[model samples]
Target: MKHELKGLYAALLVPFDKDGQIIESGLREIVRNAIDVQQLDGLYVNGSSGENFLMNTEQKKTVFRIAKEEAQNEIKLIAQVGSLDLNEAIALGQYATELGYDALSAVTPFYYPFTFEEIRDYYFKIIEATQNDMIIYSIPGLTGVNITIDQFKTLFENEHIIGVKYTAPDFFLLERLRHAFPDKLIFSGFDEMLVQAAISGVDGAIGSTYNINGVRAQAIFKEARLGNVEKAYALQKESNDIIESVLNMGLYPTLKAALGEKGINTGLPKAPFHPFDESLRPQLKSLIQKYNL
Candidate 1:
């Protein structure tokens, strides 16, 4: 099935106060910046980057609702409603479908060392219940459940199982999957590897760093595909510099801090995730000015 839900998407970040309460205005500001300023193609709400795993069911739904409302069908939206709780996944999937998300993505069931069949069944259950297009979230590094090409073959047998958010660095498998399933959509999940993934034939990308560096991400993806290798790599190098620093200071908090610097009201991260270090403000500010983020 040819779908229109393909392009550069900010893995949608959420802001919260000290009590881990969602900051509604801050959240709206972030969404607005993503659409208006960053010019992202879409928002991937309630995904790992949004700290989805840390929030309860109600919080997740609130995010989905808020993003949909703020976006108002201006850009395509994909909801990452995956949870270890199967029932929650179904309910969230149904909810996002009702909210008119362009598509639904769910991480592979993790932390239990589930067999391939069980994981397959988990996806099947969500798709069957929600009756929406499903994109498999395959980040084996985090999930520890790797689906081989043949297994993907089996999952893709279902028309509702439309594609995958391929997060691993294994280009051989990516190439093979591209060759094997020309019809299925494949979105690269890593921001740092945007250039390579674009050249590897991914339909688009869903990334965390895209929240801040989406313009460059869009450039890298387009330049690489247009065979402007040198220009694409230049942007990738710049983006990687930002990614590396963000990883060093911290991913979520640091990104929020970067946005907060722009007066976007990106409050502190949820509890237990440390606030962005005040001492690093100088370095963060330097990065912001240097990159024009």
Candidate 2:
């Protein structure tokens, strides 16, 4: 059976010790909060917000294992197994499938300036590697490659291919994709842009900010689906305000700090990315309380 990849999914944050080691307990707590407390519809594991780029293969696999074991099929789990290495991508995809992940997503192969054909081949290879359905992760800002409408059509034609995590700000293209393939699932990648993406008919959202603000995000989506634009707009504005503050405070670090303050022990982000200082802890605490996160 095909997997149903829809609704508000948190692009989970990976916590690490001060020594830059994965804090398994902290990570499990965070995932539990996202699933049981926040009541998110699902999780998007190992995305940019999860610090996937900084992690090695073993670390990535550990995250997948822990998330799956802890999640225990309570909610949907979409494992992001994408990488620049095609072989690694396939390996991770298969591994995640075996771990009972609901679906697999891969960000467009990045950094090497691959041709369109090469990108297509990358997806083809991953889909061929496992029987699990795939979601194309299109974050042009990070990947430097945006799958065009034509490319999307080509991909959706594949039986195992399901949908995309559409991250770009271009609503025109998003509208076009929706018009062209009404049945395909399209997840909004930008938390700030969720209102517009939902307005444009995105099936759901996978956002970093949802970890803390999931209730509000869910309200926005529910209101929009109910045709209450005015209410949805108000909630979206609140979400954007929180996200703006997070961006200013350093996205990953601030998020971890906020989680830590909430007693999740989200640890520090894996390295090259610094943890928020003791001074900033008070500020993050204030922000969290202010937002009622």
Candidate 3:
């Protein structure tokens, strides 16, 4: 709560070796790229972009440790400690808090058909255990747990439950949350919709694409805040062209491939997630060249 968590954040991408192990050196490089090159405000480590679900608990901790040690508080570092296992989430939350993460975000408890009360209790347990500010990572499109405004009201009652990384496409709910909980921090999650969320008054944003397109994202955020919607829209259009291509080629792999082109060892996406097609390299290069990414 004290960090005044606002501004553009790369959903911090982690690099891996062929054996699907954490490429620590590569990760340190990526963090440096985000802070130094991209000029992003923070790194959302171990979020969806980091392939959190695929990693073991130790791997997640390693990411938090490396990002903190590397960043050295130069920029904000948010550790996504959410997991299906409650104990794991708690342990990870504690670890991140100790390491000085700016904030802790947890995806809504998923997989099981958990009731609202169960979900609420899950958040409470983590906050109580860690004693750190919490951001609810609500991406119902993938998690299938849609939280209602009334439910949000219940969750926001706790002072430690600081805000949410709202990844859903519901602008209506986003607006309502903004109007209702004006004090709570709201981070827009979907990269392609950054302009709309910025216009709707989100504190800032977090996304995977920001790793490559962060400078533009900062422009869009600043322009929109300054009431330059036309400029923001134009930039958004150009950004969407890039985002569409990345999604079509493959999300994580294509992003890594883009970063790789810049001499950053971003490696490939983790197992179960396929790599970007070699055939697409020409096109991906065109994007990198076009965007100067």
Candidate 4:
């Protein structure tokens, strides 16, 4: 089936208990709130914001299953099934497809320094393994591997490869891609960069900060799309200010805490990912209230 995937999607936060277990109930509630109340365009499950790297295969599958079940087809779900292991990535892709995810995205492989040819092979392997359409995730900073314009063209040559979740700040390349592939979908990956991305013709954005600030992000995109630069910039500035606080307080913990403050109770981050400083909760709360998040 042709997918109607576009617009502002939140890279969901996975809530874990103190013992580092996925808090399924809490997560279900968070997803529910994100869809039912926040009214976001979609959910980007198991991405960088979702802490996918820290979890194992079983844990990742469990998250995929829970997110799908709770979403109940109410909103679009893009499963980030990418991993360092090619076989494992394929398995997750097939699993998510079977579970009814709307689309699948995979990060460029990291560590061990794979060549561009290897990266090309990796995406080819994934597209060949599953019938699901793919979105190439190009986050150069984290994965240390970037799909250059030529590489992206190679991947998009696959009829099933629909688009990309581009996280870098390279507007020149972004402009080039938009100009080259006007028909393909390109969702910006950085929440803070949504205005520029939207102006450059990005279809939408998938971001961690959107988990809390989706309403405003949606406004920014809507206004920008309609040529309301002043309004969009004002909203973008507000969103960026909040994101700045999130970066200072910590991304995952601040997200969890904000969710809890909203009464969703996402608990805390998994171990080795430290909790937000308790002292900063007041500051976070004030910021959230200030932004009406």
Candidate 5:
């Protein structure tokens, strides 16, 4: 269990064609880049970076199947089955489990002020149905729901609630969690704060940027773990420069654009999220040149 996960994972970004249909071939290219070029530890399929929320049921399953098929034992895979719909979440969980995903992560149900018990039970039901290890996906910034330390403790009581993909910026809670649950897996979510989280003792990190810039992120995590703060900080600073540019340009689109530079054919972002701004191409290219991404 300890070795199943614990390293950098690209929260995969999916590509879509003009008609808003998934470009399967492009997605396979991204997976190969992550494995062959970036040499990442793993891939986190169908998460926020995948523009998952914008996709429907069939599309999500398609991503799970494609990622699993492409990755195909090359590296670990965590399927993000979280959805606003609990039934959908459970169904996805079972599907991923059947596909033999390394683990299943579900975002805390959002859009309503659900009690901790409600949230806790949601996780329980998914675990019971799927009978697979679960990682709590806590990104309060996006979900508008924050799980307290006590809430995490309660959830972890089940043991099947293996760890968390903690996406918030609260280092205090991060430190507390590290000390409190030394045995569980904890993957940091933000690329900009990778060094900080590594210093705080997270098991690993998952980021959208890792899809293209994982070579540098791997260096950052390695330096920090080796107690080389100065080098790690330097790398973190450099990575954040790229992340800032990506965020400014639009996270998914800008990331796909980086892959596009590598001649991977990663398509544009799904509908309503807008495309890579043609005007921003030069800025993104500058980042690619600077980072050698």
Candidate 6:
């Protein structure tokens, strides 16, 4: 578990029943696929792709525990412990850290227009409480909270706040972040732009699509970082095709369906998020076979 925290990680997709319960069996299978089959460097558990926001605290803890047990320290695990309730975030951070998660990540608190000072304090409290390495999860599209370079400087002041899951499409900001914090680990959160981010010098990536297309993702990152833009771009284009289809069909459900086709028992997305459209099943199946996912 003391592995280098820099590499391709699947932003883990959870298997949930219609009752919004974690399907433990399916979860184990998915973990094994990521480690033994996909051969990803890590698993970013309970992040957005796992529908963390939709699960209760205890359910989140269940995911943390299950992922750790299944992984058994074979692969790196970064638990996303962020919540609107600061205490919940801290408690989950403590839970994950104690469970031996390699690192803890928290999305910027959203829903209320929290001040920058308040946001800074949120992360500080979690780190102080858990005393574990932290990765700032910066996804501006969902949270609407953009951390500028100066703000990042303030956050990085906490030596324990190791790096960030940079999800936005702002290449300029990414280049600036790389130049500004060369020592910190910067993980690209968007799969479609993995090549671009790798070209811009991202240390690694954490992506939802990696759950299905991880081998290609790893190749894209490796080739791009090695200055093989042509080779990297080729893989990126292939990945983008899969991503474009998945997004159009529905993200979580389509992913679950893809895994289901492989007999993984990936149940369904939590409520309010609709299940994969049965009408699109043929297209999803075709995508899976076409890409050999």
**What TM-score would every model get versus the actual structure?**
0.98, 0.97, 0.98, 0.98, 0.98, 0.98
Identify the leading candidate in terms of lDDT: 6
Worst 10 residues of 3 by lDDT: 1-10
Clashing pairs in 2: none
Superposition TM-score, candidate 3 onto the true structure: 0.98
Q: Please report the TM-score between candidate 2 and the true structure.
A: 0.97
Please give, for residues 34-104, the per-residue lDDT of candidate 4 as tens digits.
Answer: 88767798999998888889999999999999999999788899999888888999999999999999988
Evaluated against the true structure, the overall lDDT of model 5 is 0.93
Q: For model 6, how does the per-residue alpha-carbon lDDT over 3-29 read when each residue is reduced to its tens digit?
A: 399899999989999898999999999
Residues 1-293, model 2: lDDT tens digits? 34366799999999998787789998899899898777899999999999999999999999999999999979899999999888888999999999999889999988998998898888989989887898999989987897788988899999778899999999999999999998888899999988888888889999998888898999999888888999999999998989988898899988888877778989888879877767766777778888899
Question: Please, what are the lDDT tens digits per residue for candidate 1 over residues 13-104?
Answer: 99999999899999999999889888888888999999999999999999999999999989988889899999999999999999999889
Q: Residue 72 error for model 6, in Å? A: 1.1
lDDT for every model?
0.92, 0.89, 0.93, 0.88, 0.93, 0.94
Clashes of each: 0, 0, 0, 0, 0, 0
| Model 2: CA > 4 A from native | 1-3
Q: Comparing candidate 1 with candidate 3, which one achieves the higher lDDT?
A: 3
- Residue 44, model 6: Cα distance from true site in angstroms: 0.3
Off by over 4 Å in 1: none
RMSD of 2: 1.1
